[model samples]
Target: MSDNGTNTTDATAYDYSLYYSEDTSFFTPCNELDLKAFASVFLPALYSMVFVLGFLGNGLVVCVLVKHRNQTNLTDMCLFNLAVSDLLFALTMPFYAHYSAVSRWTFGEFMCRFISGCHHTGFFSSIFFMIVMTLDRYMVIMHTHKVARYRTLRAGLTLSAFVWLLSLCVSLPLMIFTEVSGDLYGLVCIYAPDNRAWKFYNVFVTNMLGLLLPLVVMVGCYSKIIPRLVNMKTAKKHRVVKLIVSIVVVFFIFWAPFNISIFLQFMQREGHLPNECKFYRDIKLAITVTETFAYTHCCLNPIIYAFVGQKFMKRALQMLSKWVPRIHFPPSRDLSEISFRRSSVTSKSSDITSTIMM
Candidate 1:
């Protein structure tokens, strides 16, 4: 019925009449006991931490972007959208935390669908935005003159809108297929497609659009960007390049294991991987652990940006300095360091090789 992305249907085949019923007298409970204790204790706590950190981090990122919205480059515009996606993704963690804490869905059918849609939408947007950001960097650093006209605010916003529109199309199945099922033993919200074809379609599309395509495009973009970096002499811009590279690698590090496990599980379900109790249990546990780790990416982004982006740090400091009267520095630190970037953009607006966009 499926290939990847952890839909319950992708595993063991089930007879719907037994699990789905109008009778309230009898019900089927979610039988995910192998990792029950681990899930109940670990998932809620981990999700809670991610929620707090991601929400705060992405919130600050958005604030910084808005404060400098007028001054932001194309990459910053991409990052602004990325932060928004992370914040939205973080918003879904609490619902999942609750789902894990109690081992059930108490929020009703409507929310079951809503949360799933939001979760997948956030995933699609995050990776797609990263790909877009990478392409922007590649163009800005490698093909400056040719891509100059498309590096402006209106162009960036237009491209962003298209990515979201495509993301929406990819994520629409979640809202349509997700459902709250099982008995009062505890309701479970999951991908519950009415048919096997739909199940296969969902998994296939999700993997291709959500993971594989973005990864391929990003790898290609970096192939070009890295060589340009090697030849560059600018000390300050190296930090920006490093930051972007670190974010890409970290993001893949977090998400790859979970997605790989899902793919393996699909293979097993389709008789490709060895089907045994031990292997099945291992895959299930791997998914639980990797999924937890993957969620941390949302929380780690701002830390990476702050650590590597000097200009961003300077701006962040400027923002904080406005609020903290006791922490005083020379007022000249604000726009003087940033004005050079604006001036550079104007003269070399067509020549990306002349100056790197911060």
Candidate 2:
């Protein structure tokens, strides 16, 4: 009887060991997600919403800017290119939505590479344009006298092209590495770093080059602007400054979480972090949630532009005048009351223009 009892206890203990075994994903050659139905179901809806909003908002921006392409100023040029980047990025969301829903790259390998490259390309270009846009604002506010020669339409287009090229250079490596592979239960489309060293460098370089540098430039621009804003007596200047500040804050809010999580992931993978089961699970969850949050940043800019950019609001009203028969604003009203401040062609003259799109 005692022998039988001992055997039964041993069997129970073995079953417990099986139940509590470490998730071997931590030791695997590649990162794997033990995804549940929750991810498959929940993420599709969010991605869809982002796609819809992003498309509509960015489309409107393109339409408005292109219609007045001949008259577009430096800031208008920035807004237009920024919208282009967002629109391109948003186009790839449906593919990702399907990927999220199915947890597979059903579109095949070419698509796996193409779609991934496009999104990252758009990601880099958009942020680069944003950084340039902020720097343009800084130049206008602080060194208006010296900046006019370089803020021309030709200059802006050249800069935009340069940014796009830079984006392509940054994203090309991702295309080479992206592949579809089977992880125990299913197939995954992932960035297949060749080794641990490559993986670490990939995470380190992408985030550092793509995120950290731009963030510093944006922050520095806004920090300098803040003191000037406080000293300004005009309510209109305050409003413009406030809108710019809000834009900077929103950009940081959406992007910082995702990149910070990437840093944590690097640490954990490198054994700098404790390998607790719950911690790993939470980090994985955070990455999924935060990455989706980051995707929304592509579309969110137009909403902010619409609400806060008073001049842009005026132009929207003008556009609506055609569709809404009774709607009309006086021709004498400020067409662009609060433009990004700029100086005239002559360095000798400090004549500033108050033309921003409404």
Candidate 3:
């Protein structure tokens, strides 16, 4: 004011500007309202859909296989057990949905442990069964002559028991680690420990044992199987191979990304990476959605199996025939017979019968 030299005595107090170098953490206020709305609406809907579909799908597969008593073969028994594990897992989804919708865990500590234990149990069981299935397929196709003796009902039952025991062992950590905790938002069921080590332990164990190893086995088995399938000239064999390939493809497509995302989340949580990154958050959300879809594959299999299983379409038609009014439908020719007729200029009756049988 003195330097400006107009009226130093009555100079007004200068209004100085205050500048803030924004802290990244303080940039975005925790939008509690948005989070609550998301939890109340979208989470519940997602969980409900996954739960209902997974339960029905897995249940139907188990019922159909068990009722027919057609799952005596080791491979078939393994598939049946896989369905059972998936159904059990599906059972817990409603509880999760309820918690998410309410934005709190009204269930007690015991239930929190139980639910978490069941989730791991199902997951490990599913992985074990899938691995067994892949191994069985490999043996059946590549070493059929030598491995035929091991495909008995007794062997199947023993293997299934071992898988169950292994799964139970894997789930033991859940019983020990899972707990219910209260925060400003609500009571959250979380894995609480003194240090972050257990979180890393859980993530590594699940990613390696539950996902990576099994995936490697599946891929290895299929790689060898594909060449054998290609060389087979018979239509029936080719169809069966194609069906199995489709199942493998679907499994990989639905699960690979989900598991990868889960691994990343684990890394983020352990301070190996920053969790506040927007990209990470988006990936986490995507993983949650994708995992839900992947879980639905457990239900999708029965539909696939019904279509591809031996004589399933015929049996389904027979069942339909009982409900519908009798109408004259044209007799369906065997696909093999049609193919033989088209390929061979001189079509012998014996050739037609052989092709039909094949």
Clashing residue pairs, candidate 3?
Answer: none
- Give the least accurate 10-residue stretch of model 1, judged by summed lDDT: 12-21
Largest lDDT belongs to which candidate? 1
Per-candidate Cα lDDT values, in order, are: 0.68, 0.66, 0.61
For candidate 3, write residues 71-156 as lDDT tens digits: 35665687779888888778888887787677667888888888877877887798788888878777766675788787799898
For model 2, residues 1-358, the per-residue Cα lDDT tens digits are: 1221111111010011111112244433323345445567767888898899999888888888887787888788888888988998888889878877766557777887788788778877888888887788778767777987888988987988899999888777766666655444344556665555655555755577667888899789878866654564444555666676777788878888978876786577557887776666676667667877888987788876553565566566677677676966554356234223433332112122132212
Off by over 4 Å in 2: 1-35, 321-332, 336-358
Give a tens-digit lDDT track for model 1, residues 147-256: 87867888888988998888778788756877766643355666666777876866576567656787788778877777766565544445546655776688678877
Clashing pairs in 2: 311-357, 311-358, 312-357, 312-358, 313-358, 314-358, 315-358
User: On lDDT, who's better, 2 or 3?
Assistant: 2
State in Å the error of residue 243, model 2: 1.5
Q: Residue 11, candidate 3: how far off, in angstroms?
A: 61
**For candidate 2, which ten residues in a row score worst on lDDT?**
9-18
- Cα RMSD for candidates in order: 6.2, 9.7, 14.1
- Residue 125 in model 3: shift from native, Å? 0.9
